[model samples]
Target: MRRVPESAEAARTLVRTALAAWGQRDLIEDAALVITALVSNAVHHARLESIRVIVTRPSEKCVRLGVVDRSRNIPYLRTDSDGDNTRGRGLLLVDALTDRWGTDRYRWGKQVWGELTCD
Candidate 1:
C-alpha cells in the first residue's frame, strides 16, 4: 500500500472487510484499530513510500495483522508522552486492544504484528 496518510484508513477498511467476510465481525473494530496504528507508525516513522499489510488467521479464534515497512526501527510505547498529545498514542492503543503484539526485524526492514481474538 502507498505510505500516504490515507493508508491507515485504507488498511482499516481492508481489515474490516476481511474480518466480516471471514465471519469474524466481532473483531473488526479492534482489528481496525490495531491495523491503523501499525500502518500509521510505518507511514509516519519509517517514512516508506510503500508498505505492506498482511492479515491471516493462525487459528479458529484469532486473527493476525501485520504491517511491513522499509525501516528496521522497532516501535516502543511512549510512556513519557503527554496525556493530551495526539501523535504518540498509536502503540499504546495497539497494546491495549490487541491480545498479543510484537515486532520482527529483517535485513530489508521490520514488520509489526498484532493479534486479535474473535471469540
Candidate 2:
C-alpha cells in the first residue's frame, strides 16, 4: 500500500490477518472500519509517497490500530452541516465504533489511532 486510496483495503486486510491470528476475529469488522477511515484520510490529505499501518495488541483484550503519514495536519471530527451530508463522517464513525481514539505526533508525521476492546 503506497499512499493511495486503495491502501485502505490493504490496511484492512492486515488488520484482519493480525486480529484473527490473535483470536480476535470478532474485531475484524470494526477494525476494518477504522483502518479504512484512517488510511483514507492519509491518502487524501497527506500527499506523501508512503504511509504506515499498525495493528498492535496493547493488551490481551485490546487492539490498537494506527495509520501514520508524513503530514503535519492532524485529523479532527468535522462538524457536519446537516444530517443529509454524505461526506466527512469518517471520524464520527471511528468515535462511535472505538472505545477510544487519538493521535501520536512525530517530527516526520502523525499516527491517528483507535482502540477496540473485546467485550
RMSD of each predicted structure: 1.2, 1.4
The residue pairs found clashing in candidate 2 are: none
The TM-score leader among the candidates is 1
The digit string of per-residue lDDT tens for model 1 on 3-112 reads 98798888988898889899998888888889988988888988658999999999988899999998988899888858777998898999999988999899999999
Which portions of model 2 show Cα errors greater than 4 Å? 82-85
RMSD after Cα superposition, model 2? 1.4
Candidate 1 to native Cα RMSD, angstroms:
1.2
For 1-119, candidate 2 gives per-residue lDDT tens digits of 59988888889899999998988888899999999988888888886799999999889779999998899888898875768877678899899999999989999889999999974
Q: Local distance difference test, per candidate?
A: 0.89, 0.89
TM-score of 2: 0.92
Q: TM-score for each prediction?
A: 0.93, 0.92
